[model samples]
Target: MSSTLTVTGGAPLKGSVAVRGAKNFVTKAMVASLLGETTSRLRNVPDISDVAVVRGLLELHGVRVSEGAEDGELVLDPADVEVAAVADIDAHAGSSRIPVLFCGPLVHRLGEAFIPDLGGCRIGDRPINYHLDVLRQFGAVVDKRPSGIALSAPRRLRGTRISLPYPSVGTTEQVLLTAVRAEGVTELRNAAVEPEVLDLIAVLQKMGSIISVDTDRVIRIEGVDSLTGYEHRALPDRIEAASWGAAALATGGDVYVEGARQPDMMTFLNTFRKIGGAFDVDDSGIRFMHPGGPLRSIALETDVHPGFMTDWQQPLVVALTQAQGLSILHETVYENRLGFTDALVRMGATIQVYRECLGSTPCRFGAQDFRHSAVVSGPTRLQGADITVPDLRGGFSQLIAALAADGTSRVHGIDLIDRGYEHFAEKLAALGAQAVRDEEPARV
Candidate 1:
């Protein structure tokens, strides 16, 4: 049976919580360990289901994953890495999209890699075609079966020039993982340079890969003949930090998210300030809260990198419901991320979804007739309602709405949030939010 959360709303949440390594970067870095000649130590690892999923996949491929020198650290030994049976991989893979990332490292080491049917959040058309295309460009053969895809590199995989249709983070990561081991120089155009991607690049550099980033969204990598394991700390999760900042705004409370860095979150920080939310950043972390005043509404847009992140828009939308006027948001990264706002509408939020682009940016989805724009009319007093968790970010967005509403709210399918957010219920309690697991049946 699935777990649910019963939340009593209309209370302010205050206090502090710590964020660890990013779920996006840490998982990819674990896959990168496969290319190492020795053991790799990854620090600041968060306790999230996605990390466990990656660990399971690594162990299945004969990599030894163990505890590091201290807590929130992982030691990955790729010295004895060997190919495992297909059934073993599928059995351990579960419903994770991480297996697709293993294609490059596995092919480079064992010359063949089998991928299980990949699954992740139902965000949008996040296809593996781009990854497969990149692999094929690097002289890898792709074969599709009922179970999953199999990739084989018959000859020494050599680097090739590639250009992405969009600046996709996953595809860019796949190329980085593959190109670092190829025989020659690889150039990528229209590449995504998200901070998480840069952290992965740093991990690769620590392992002896020579990569250069050009100013015009171009990345060049010179494959090294060999690589050693790396000892490095992963970057903190900016998405999680921004979610908590939005929580502080939605609940009209103060929250100090320790370990949140400013450089990576500059875009989000500036946007949060324009909304009339208060924040203070130091060397440790950022403290976010709502000052007693009228919250102003503003037009916002989500983009790839160096722009407002699409992941940050969900929870921030909950906070926008408390703003004095309408706030328009254009989601360019993912077309369907705004679908989660329907539950908010059920909880007395005034949100209208439109096919046209609503914000300042003209995105590719503008002409595609997708419901990519949302106009939030707010300062609406939200009431409690039963809701189901949709995806990772959306699940947290649901929790924010439930906490901002009056009375109690029953939230089901909350286990999905474990995929990203670490120890969220504990963090909520520490913040003085009345959120508890509902062991009993729901009240109808």
Candidate 2:
């Protein structure tokens, strides 16, 4: 059953919050554990639902999984793995995008793999075409079944040259995982260089992968015969950090985002500064706070990497509503990302969705009724209301907006937010935000 969050409004949050290992990278790294013969001891792992989902998939394949007392670490014992439970694999395959990541590793270990359908944030029509196409290029036979993807590598895998139409993060990860264990050299251009992707590469390298990154977004990987287990710490989740930063600015409070890396978050940091959010970064973490006066609004475009991230745009847009000036946001990653913002509009935010493309930026978004662009008129006085969560990141945006609004809010489908966020209820409490779990059903 799903859960709901009841938030009492009007709180000034002040506290130190530690970020978790990235949900994106850690799940892929867990899948990589299947490729190695030794046990994979992953550190700084987050206690998120996605991680639990991946852990279930790994253990279903006969890998022994164990956890520590602290929520920061996990041990994946893939030494006795058996690819026997196709039904369990099929059930979870439809649950997340990370299950599709296991295809390359499973094919390498068991010669054939059946992957269930992938489900993630419904921001756009996220096709697995590039991923399938890249796998096919590596000489794997792929058949799209009703339940999942059936894959077979008849011969030993061989890598080839591949370039993505767009620098998609999932497809890039697919190519990296499939090509690293295949024969010959694989060259990838226009690859995703997100921090998560880089962390995956770091994990692969520790597991005996020979990967080299060059200028102009080029990546070359040499396939090896065998790989051993890897022990490594994951990079801090930038999305979670950005979400809390947005919350701090929106609520006119001070928050220290511990374990957040500054170098990987320069784009977000700069944009938040433009929005009148002041921050200080040391080796440990980042501290975000509001200035004395009204916060400003800045134009934003969500791009692949080195650009503003698509996931960060939703929560940041909520903070923009409290800004004095107008904010223009062009969602370049997903077409339907702005739909969840409509819930904010219902709570007194001045936001309008547009069909036309705002400007010519490097994005797949075109002139259509996709509502890919959002224009928010600021200084909004938001009133709390009952909100339903459509997806993980969108749910957190609603939570932040609700915390910043007046009165109380009942956020339904709160469990969806827990799929990615770690210790959010306790963290909210730590920040002086009053939140309680409602046992009764939430009224839509």
Candidate 3:
């Protein structure tokens, strides 16, 4: 597929598109297969690049990966798990940050593990200090090499108590993947309780790990000596579902997102209603639509689970551009998330970014210099312009903006959307979006 997409806008998108397993949960669950003694089966997996990266990394470590009888099913066998060559692992460097997650599971199967430098979306500060610190607490020796960081377990890894300064999803995943097989019990405070994290805990439980979650942000895991393989179906990608929902609202269309569960999108549903969007939920999926009336502006703040997700804000920002009056979006999760609004501004939306915390509650970024707050003044008519996709979610937001605008737009860097959103271009076509892959080469 070409990297550029030419989109003709100003039409409502109406139809249904199915969403599969979450990119966030599926990748980690694939990594968890390394801890099992037998083959594991995972279902509802999506055809995303991130999953392919993890599968390749797993194969490099000698895990046999194959398809199951059903579509979107993967059978992973780690019976021959071994150390991958440093050079081979180096080839995957900067492709994804998932490689760093291989540290604990690899150190368990092989006495030592080497991980190339990690790379992910250029969102904000995602330091690996928390991951390294938690690993060191589990008795793993960390050696920083030029090519990548090497970790070794001199003795059996022991469980330790940990309290994260914030409820970071990645750090919490690192702790869980490491603590599941460590000796004794591991208690983690201030952990992320996102649906994806809970789903991962469910996967671990199926694999014979004793895990408990409290009402508060506390998790305790009892280590077991051995684990057998598991048969599990991953949760649907709520981010992708919400992105489509936002797209529907932005274009004044109706979209039925199959596999979108109501339980996972309560907060977003409430916000969607507040912004004059309507949804009908059934067992199979949810249908998101813009009510006939004007879109209402809202005050939203991005937070962890049960709060407005940071990932949900970008595409919704496009919807906000057509809403009546002013809308305030204070991004408390990633500092640079609001930077995507600049593209919306270039497309003729009225948006202003600020460093001050615009939400009711002051957040960690309040004192920082990062422009994490955005105030959108809208009911402005959007005109299409040439756009360059930035990151995954941001790229999807730009696509929504282009579809909502008048005239034509040529969107570059569209491949980035494939990293998280599964077959999005095809889905857009299924939804009646007037977009086609550009046959000509993308501009340098």
Candidate 4:
């Protein structure tokens, strides 16, 4: 497949696109299947590269992965679980950071695990210290080496109390995956309460794990001796839905996103409406339309759940470029997330990056030197320019900008989008976007 796209702009994107399972949750759920003793069935799986990476890693460790009767269903059986060779595991290094997550499950199943150095999108600092600390607290031995970290359990892991410095979703997932099989009760403070995390908890519960969530950011899990497989359907990708919604707003188009649930998107929906984007919610999905006027500029901040998501900011920033006045965005989740706006500026959007906290409250990055905030002043015409895909969300944002720009744009590294977006080219086609793969003849 081609890694470049030729995009012709000046037209609004219109039509419908379907979103499958969330890349964030489905990949973690696939790892959870490693804990099951029998065959686990997963539905609504998207055909993203991250899922493929996890599947390859799972198969390397002796899990039998197969397709189910229905489309988007996966059958994973861990009956023949075994220790993967260090060299073999090392070969998968840099492909994904998911190997770090395999530590708890692999140790529980095979007594030891070798995880190569991790790699992921370069949005900001994503240290593995929290994951390592969580594993050590559970009585696992961690030996750091040049190639990767090696972990082993001398005896059955015993759960202990843990408190995260922040409500990190990845760290929270590590704790949950490890805690369920530990020997005692586990108490976690400052856990992420995102809907995806809650869904993961539901999946674990179906596997006979005792877990509880308090009103506060607290999670408790009782260790079980054994776990059976589970049948689960993953949740839709709310981030993708919001991205398309932003696309519609940026291009003055109307797009109906199928499979978008309103409950998981209330925060984003509220923000979208405040920006002069109109939406209608139904049982199946939501239809987003630009309400034929100058978009209102508003102050927004990215935070944990119940607040705007950091991932939703980049693409929406593209829409903000079309707003009538100045829009302030404070990114609290990842410090370098605002870096993608440079490309927007190159494409003729008036944007300025800053190092200070521009939001109502201070964040962890406020004490640091990262440029974590942005000011976008707009209603300026966007001109097409050459763009390169940065990270996942930023790359998608660039695509949205290209579609909304005037004239033609040559976008490189489009394959990066395949990491999270499933069948995006087809989705663009259905939405009447004038984009063609660089490998093919350009359409007039």
Candidate 5:
């Protein structure tokens, strides 16, 4: 059995919806609080399940988290940080990869850290090897067990040089969180400069750490002996904002997304414009709408920061289904990202996934047998169908498909959608879509 949403199609989702913190940064910022000797205040936090999950994990480890002076604010105090029971740690962190981030702060504060089995979206192969290897470079010894991995600093962790084979966002985060309080200066090459990472750096700076980022992708962090509290505002979630923008384009709707920063979405905005979508930018937010014309097609490829993000690719594919010609996308970031297109195909979208790279330059997965490229032919009228939600971004793409199709569409497994999107169903209702709830029996 699963929770389902029945959506009536052909209605534009026109209205304003608010977006809070970037989930990528807020969760890590919460983990950074474990390094502080005093209370840390994080504002503009979103009411997402990931935030709640991280808060629970922090509370489990004796970190105190409470509401701040305003709504969407969190006060995290690390005064009582301690090692938690392994079973409780396992239970609290069920399938979340966040526990891996606790290693650096815990090793500095308590000399040891235990990470339960890690989990995240089933997008691709996300291994903790990069994280573990980085920790080892910092003098932490790692021991593997059945339940999880245990890490201990035989001596105080010391800063070391690191060069990543790729600019993986997760590994870069692990390095930044751990390097801040290490014994000496640490240099990281080929680091990720995504906006979320930069915002996390801002949070750490407010907490009394010295870090530098160079245009050549080199980040140097000087370890400080001690740190205090911080009061900082989190960057708004650009992924969520882009998701709604793609939705407006797909349904021919007008959407005003409050708190969406234009600088963070320049790549996506440029691509949106090339596809014939119209947008207006203002100080408060950006508004995306259809200009009542036939949408043009585009050639797009997902890449690292400052390129089209893999997270943005999934939702935007929904809009491509309505374009006038062929839209080709080379998903260079994640090999299995195109898996979600299967559900879109079921919903009457003419999308084909390929193994070889379809762009000018072949990416890492080009030679691999993974389906990493897609060609979508559109101006095709979509119809309603029964679909199952795949992952977080994919789930939203499914929702867009359902909203754009004619007649009623039944979508199952929306609990996956709740992981990142906050009150999405309510937001959809507010946007004038005829979306309603329905319960279903078991699939097997």
Candidate 6:
């Protein structure tokens, strides 16, 4: 759906809001259900498009996905999973990053499987080469086909030691899901220990999977003979929480983000403090407010877990525009993520993309043009203008920029935002922001 945002400029949003299950975590957990020997029950599921897309993909496999009366509850049965949907599977592979995760489970259950192309944010060339390497280590013969990825393993899969070149969340989850059913123990080094990955591990553990996380970026999973179903509650969306929190900071308002857990926000909180954003945490949720001090610019570098998340960079950058002085942002995750700043420039923010990475840290954006890094000269006036969203967190940054700007701003391609944010319109309305769901102007 299309969205038009009209803001009067410089209005601090004041209200209480709540978040739901994480889009990233829930979608992968849905894929995890395929490994279940019995029905798996998942609660706190978000009503986002990505979840629906995954549900449709499961149904194509003959899995039954039924929603509960309560919001975000689901019953998943994998007994009817179809092993031969090359065309349908190919179509969905380009939709989200979770589709490639089916490789291991499909290989374990049917001894053969095909997965279509995978799709997600265009921040970088997120290749599945690492995933394929790990799968091969598990004794699966994998090949790339014109339609999708084809795999076969007549022999019982044997787990082997694998290492990731990067701490990719998708790659880590893929290895975890596939290795669990293989024979012997699998060791993964340089794994992505995102909270979502840990949450999926928790679900897998309940389903009788043996996995262990070491302090030094190591993960050990033992392949089991059979697996049972599980009842699990999805983790809260930390990226969404940070988005709203950044919105509050950008708009100079106070918002209590309900259902926002603090355990996942230490990095964000520390960064927010550097910008003079104040917050308090309670059992109900967290509250964000600017302490009426000058917003200071700070250096930020994105890394894997226990570090600032790459997903949170774009939205937080918008808030940085209101801060004083030059803020140095080095994106170490994806190369092309900084492109979203161009949209923000149209709305009157002073940001310059750079090819030279100046920071001393080991950032990934050094070779790439502005796609990797940017300099935000903030404390500038932002006026509302029509803008189009390019990605998930970038979409929310557009909304935050529009709300902070004067006059009306129309944000198109908002359906992309629904892939992550749940009930966003309703939440924005509740928080005293005048945002509406409207159709775009008909082409002449």
Model 3 scores a TM of 0.98
**TM-score of every candidate:** 0.98, 0.97, 0.98, 0.98, 0.98, 0.96
Cα-lDDT of candidate 1: 0.93
lDDT of candidate 3 over 1-444, digit per residue (tens): 348889999999999999999999999999999999999999999999899999999999999999999999999999999989999888865668998789989888888888787888888988899999999999999999898799999998999999999999999999999899999999999999999999999999999999999998999999889898999999999999999999999999999999999999999999999999999999999999997889999999999988989999999999999999999989988988877778889889999999998888558898889999989998988999999888999999999999999999999888888899999889999999889885556456
**Residue 245 CA displacement from its true place in model 5, Å:** 0.4
- Per-residue lDDT of model 4, residues 68-183, tens digit only: 99999999999999988888887765668888889999999989988897888889989999999999999999999997899999999999999999999999999999999999
Model 2 residue 108 CA deviation (Å) reads: 0.6
Candidate 1 vs candidate 3: the lDDT winner is 1
How many collisions between residues are there in candidate 4?
0
- The lDDT, on a scale of 0 to 1, for candidate 5 is 0.92
Measured with C-alpha atoms, the lDDT of residue 150 in candidate 3 is 93
Q: What clash pairs does model 6 have? A: 17-258, 45-72, 61-82, 93-117
Give Cα distance to truth, residue 302, candidate 1, Å. 0.3
After superposing candidate 5, which stretches have Cα over 4 Å from the reference? Answer: 438-444
Q: Across residues 187-298, which tens digit of lDDT does each residue of candidate 5 receive?
A: 9999999999999898888888999999999999999999888998999999999999999999999999999999999999999999999999999999999998999988
Q: Count the backbone clashes (under 3 Å) in each candidate.
A: 0, 0, 0, 0, 1, 4
Distance (Å) between predicted and true CA of 163, model 3? 0.3
Runs in model 3 deviating more than 4 A are 439-444
What's the CA error at residue 134 for candidate 2, in Å? Answer: 1.1
Q: What is the total number of backbone clashes in candidate 1?
A: 0
The lDDT values for all models are 0.93, 0.87, 0.92, 0.93, 0.92, 0.85
Candidate 1 per-residue lDDT, tens place, 408-443, comes to: 999998888999999999999999989998555545
lDDT of 2 by residue, 1-444 (tens): 668899987676789899879898889988888989898889899988888888888888888989855567788888777775667776765657777787898888889887776787787898888878888899999987787779999998898999888988998899888888999899999999988998999999999999998868889999999999999888989999999999998888899999999988999999999999999999899999986689887788888888899899989998999998888888888888888897899999999988767756866668466888878999989999999988888889999989999999999988878888998999999899999986555466
At residue 270, candidate 5 shows an lDDT of 97
